[model samples]
Target chain A: MPYRYLEDIATADVAFEAWGKDLGELFAEAADATTNVMVEGLASIKRKETIDIELRNPELDILLYNFLNELVYLKDARRLLLRAYDITVEKEWPDFRLKAKVSGEAIDHARHRLKADVKAVTLHRLSVRETPEGWKATVVLDI
Target chain B: MRAQLAVPESIKKISDTVWEIPASYKPGMLVPARIYATEKLLKEMDAGVFDQVTNVACLPGIVNYALCMPDGHWGYGFPIGGVAAFDAERGVISPGGIGFDINCGMRLVLTNLTYEEVKPRLHELVDSLFYRIPTGVGSTGFIKLSFSEFEELVEQGSRWCLKKGLAWPEDLELTEERGCFAGADASKVSRKAVERGFDQVGTLGSGNHYCEIQVARPENIFDGNTARAFGFTVPDQVAVMFHCGSRGFGHQVATDYLQVFLDVMERKYGIKTLDRELACAPFNSPEGQAYFAAMKCAVNMAFANRQVILHRIREVFSNVFKKSPEALGMSMAYDVTHNTAKLEDHTINGRRTRLLVHRKGSTRAFGPGMEGIPERYRETGQPVIIGGSMETGSYLMAGLSTGAGAFYSTAHGSGRTMSRHQAKRTYRGEKLKRDMEARGIYVRSDTWGGLAEEAGAAYKNIDEVVEATELAGLSKRVVRLLPIGNIKG
Candidate 1:
C-alpha cells in the first residue's frame, strides 16, 4: 500500500497520507485510501462496473480534491464503491485536466464489509506537494 | 505521534470555568478567544482546539470573542464546539464554521411507557427500528421522489411531511425554525446535491450518528419541574433520541461553496484567512448571499430528514406495542440543531443586534423568554439534548439567560478523547456489543468496525462535560438518560 492512515491527526474523523513517484500514482493511492475508509477490504469491492471521469482545474491540489469528492459523490448518487485506474494528468498551460476510469460494484451489504461513511474530503491540512522522491498528498475526511 | 502544542502563557483564567486568550496573543485577531471549561478539561483539550479557536478570533467582523464550549475538540476549520457570532452586515460566513453536515442535530421524543415495561421487548423494539430506519453507508429511504419533487421538499422542509401525513402539526411546533428555515431557495441548490440527498431523508449516516432508545430514571432527574414540563412524567420514562444530519446533500452544498469562497475570498475581496479551510466571503457579497441561501436548503433538507425518521420511530413503537402512535403517547419534545449559521438577535455590547451565529458541533440553548423558543417551554427555556456514548448515557438540559454571553450556545455531545483508529485498536466491536447487552443495553450496528470506533472509552466523560456547562452558566441540567436500546449507523 502506498498510503497509510494518520491516527494522530484527526481526533474524531479519519486522516491519511499517500505518496507516489508521480501524480497519477499519488492520485490512485489517495483514491484507494478514501475508499478503504468506507469499506473494510479493498479486494472485496469487485470491479463489476466502471465509469469514465474527466475533470479540469488550474491548480493541481484542487484537482485532486475535486477528484476525491467526485468519488464520494458517486458512492452516494450511484451506490458504487469505486477505485481509480488508467490515470492520466495533463497540464494545459492555464489548466490541468484529469481523465481516468473508476471501477467497482454496486454496494451489496451482505457481500461487502462496510465501515465508516465518509461525508467529504476536507480542506483542513489538505495538500498535494512534489517531494524529492516523488509526490505526496494528505487528506482529512469528514466521516 | 503528533506532539501536543503547549498552552500559551498569555492565556488567563477568567473564572473557575472560563478562560480567555487575549487578542494580543496573535496579530490581526479581531477579538479575544473565550473558552468555557474547567481546569482539567482546559488542560485535556487537544492542541488543535487552541490553534483553531484562536484562528477563528482572527476572522473578519467577529463579535465580542470567539467562544468554544467545554466539549470542544479538534476539527477541520473551526474547532468542534466552536461558536462565533458575526455582524450580519459586515461579517463573513464560512462553511467551515457550520460543518459539512448542515443542521446535523438531535431530536428527543417522549413516550408513555417505562423501562420496566420496555425491558421485556427491548430486543424486538430495537430490531424493528434498525430495520425500519435504514443505517450505514449508501442506505436509501423508503420514500422515493423525482428531482423536482425533491426540490419542493427541500424548500418546504418538514412542512412537506405534514402535507403527506408523515408528521403531526405539533411536531413542527416543537422543531427549531418550525421545521422550515426561511430564505431557502431551491433554485440556489445544485442538481447534484438534490440527487445525493433526495433518497437519504430517513437514513442514519455512519460515523457517530445513531438512533437510541433511552430511559430517564427518577434518580437522574435534576429539575423535576422542567423535566415534567418536557413531558417526562412516567417514573422511568422512555424517550427516543437520534443524532443525524443532511447526509450527502449538505456535504455537497458545503463542498461547492467552499471552492467558490476559496476562489473569490482573496481575489475579489481583500480577506485573507490563516487556514484554507476557513475560506469565507463577506456577508453582503453576492457569493455570500448565494451560499447562505443554498446552505438553508440543506438546513431544511436535514429538518425534513429527521422529521421522516421520527415518523418511522413512531411507527415502530406503535407496531411493537400494538397501538396507534397517539395512543402510545409518541410525541416529539424538541429537535435542536448542532451545526448551523442562522441570523439571530442577540445583545452585543448592550445593544440588541441581529448577528449571523455559526455553531459547529454546538447547540443553541436559548434561555427563558428568548424569541423562537416554543410557547410550552417559554418560561423554563429551550430543551437541549446532549447525546453521550451509547455505552454511557445522555442528558436533557435547559438553556439559561446567562448563556447570552456565548450567544446562547452550549456543548452538543460527549466530545471524543481518542481518534477512531485508536478506539478501534483498543476495543473489539463484537465484545463491546456483548458487554453492553450484558449491562442491559441492546445495540444493533451496521458494521463491527464502525461499532468499535465509537466505544464509550473513546469519548470524554459526559458527566463532567455537562457539569462544566452548568458551572459556566450556559445551561441547566434537567435529567440524565441511560440507553436501553440503540441502532448505530
Candidate 2:
C-alpha cells in the first residue's frame, strides 16, 4: 500500500498519508485510502459503472482536495462505490488539472461490506509536498 | 509529523471546573480561552484541544472567551465541543466553527409505554426500524424529491413534514427554532449541495449515528420535577433518541463556502487564520451573508431529516404494538442542534447585545425563563439530550440559568477518547454484540466493523462528563436513559 493511516493525527476522524513517485500516483493512492475507509474490501467493488472526473485548481493541494471530495460526492449523489485508476495530473500554466476514471457499481448490501460513511474531505493539516523520493500528501477526512 | 503538545504552562486554574489560557499566552488573541472540564478530563484532553481553542481566541471580534465543554476533543479547526460568540456586526463567520454537518443534532421522543411493555418485542422493534430507516454507506432516504422540491423543503424545514402529514403540530413546537431556521434562502445554496442532499431527507448516516430505544428508570431520575415536566412520568418510561445531521447537503455547503472564504478571507478581507480550515469572512461581507443564508438551509434540511425519521419511527412502533401513534401517546420531548451558528441576544459588557454564536459539537442549553424556548418548558428549561455510547447509556438534561457563562451551551455527546482505528483493534464486534445482548441491549447494525468502532470503551465515561457540565453550571442532569434496543447506522 502506498498510503498508511495515521494513528494520532485525528481521534474522532480518519487521517492518512499517501505518497507516490509523482503527483498522478500520489492522487490515486490518496483516493484509494479514502474509499478504503468506507468499504472494507475495495476489490469487492465491481466495475459496473465508470465516472469520468476532471477538476482543476491553481494549487496542487487544493486540486487533490477537490479530487477526493468529488469521490465523496459521487458516493452520495450517484450511490456508487468507486476506485480511481487511469489517473493523470498535468500543470497547465498556473493551474494543475486532474483527470481520472472512477469505476464501481451501485452499492449492493450483499457485496459491499460497508464501514464508516465519510462526510467530506477537510483542509485540516492538509498538505502536499515533494520529498527526496517522490511526492507526498497528508489528508484528514471527516467521517 | 508534529510533536505531541503538552499542557501549556500559561494555563491557569480558574476554578475547580474551569481552566483558562490567558490571551497574553498567544499573540493576536483578543480574549482568553476557557475550558470547562474536571481536572481529570482536562489532564486527559488531547493537545489539539488546547491548540485549537486558543487559536479560536485569535479570531477577530470574538466576545468574552473561547469555550470548550467537558467533552472537548481533537477536531480539525475548532475542538469538537468548542463554542464561541462573535459580534453580530464586526465578527466573522467561519464554516470551521459551525462544522460540516450543519445542524447535526439530537432528538428525544417520549412514549407512554414502559420497558416491561416493550421488552418482549424489543428485537422485532429494532429490526423493523433498521429495515425502514436506510443506514450505512450510500444509503438514500425514502423521501425522493425533485431538485426544486428539495429547495422548497429545505427552505420550509420541518414545516414541510407537517404539510405532508409526516409530523405532528406539537413536534414542531418542541424542536429548536420550531424546526425551521429563518433566513434560509435556497437560492444561496449551490447546485451541487442540492443534488447531494435532495434524496437523503430521512437517512441515518453511519459512524456514531444511531436510533435507540431507552428506558428512564425511576431510580435514575436526577431531578424529578424537571423529569416530569419533560414527560418522564412513569417508572422505566421508554423513549426514543437518535443522533444525525443534514448529511451530504450540509457537507457540500461547508466545502463550497470554505473554498469561497479561502479565496477572499486574506486577499479581500485581510483576515488571517492559524489553520486553513479556519477560513472565514466577515459576517457582513457578501460571501459571509451568502454562506450564512445557505447554512440555514442546511439547518432546516437537518430538522426535516430528523422529522421524517420520527415519522418512520412512529410508523414502526405503531405497527408493532397494533395501536395508532396517537393512541400510544407518542410525543416529542425536544430536538437540539449540536453544530450550528445562530444570531441571538446575549449580554456583553453588562448589556444585552445581539451576537452570532458558533457551537460545533455543543448543544444550546437555554435555561428556564429564556424567551425562545416553548412556553411549556419555560419553567423547566430547554431539554438537552446527551447521547452516550450504545453499550452504556445516554442522559436527558435541562439547561440552567447559570449557563449564561457559556452562552447556554453544553456537551453534545460522550466524547471519543480512542481513535476509530484503535477502537476497532481493541474490540471485536461479534463479542461486543454478544456482551451487549447479555446485558439486555439488542443492537442491529449494517456492518461489524462499524459496530466495533463504536464500542462504549472507545469513549469517555458519560456519567463523568455530565457531572462536569453540571458542576460547571452549564446544564443540570434530569434523567439517565438506559438503552434496550438500538439501530446503528
DockQ of each: 0.90, 0.87
Q: What digit string (tens of lDDT, one per residue) describes model 1 on residues A1-143? A: 69999988898999999999988899999999999999988999998999999999998989999999999999999999999999988898799899999999989999988889989999888899999999999999999
Please give, for residues B368-460, the per-residue lDDT of candidate 2 as tens digits: 999999999999989999999999999999999999989999999999999889998999889989999999999999988789989999999
- Give TM-scores of chain A for all candidates: 0.97, 0.97
Please report how far candidate 2 places residue A63 from its true position, in Å: 0.7
Give one clash count per candidate, in the order shown.
Answer: 0, 0
- Can you list the residue pairs that collide in candidate 1? none
- Cα error, residue B50 of model 1, in Å, equals 0.6
Each candidate: chain B TM-score: 0.99, 0.99
TM-score of 2: 0.99
| TM-score of each model, in listed order | 0.99, 0.99
For every model in order, the fraction of real contacts preserved is: 0.88, 0.87
Model 1 TM-score is 0.99
lDDT of 1 by residue, B1-489 (tens): 232344667889999999999999888899999999998888889888888999999999899999999999998789999999999999999999999999999999999999999999999999999999999989999999998888888889999999999999999999999999988998888888987888898898999999999999999999999999999998999999999999999999999999999999999999999999999999899999999999999999999999999999999999999999898899999999999999999887788898999999999999999889999999999999999999999999999999988999999999999999999999999999999999999999999888998899999999999999999999999999999999999
Give the per-residue Cα lDDT of candidate 2 at B126: 97
Top of the candidates by DockQ: 1
List where candidate 1 sits over 4 angstroms from the true fold.
B1-5
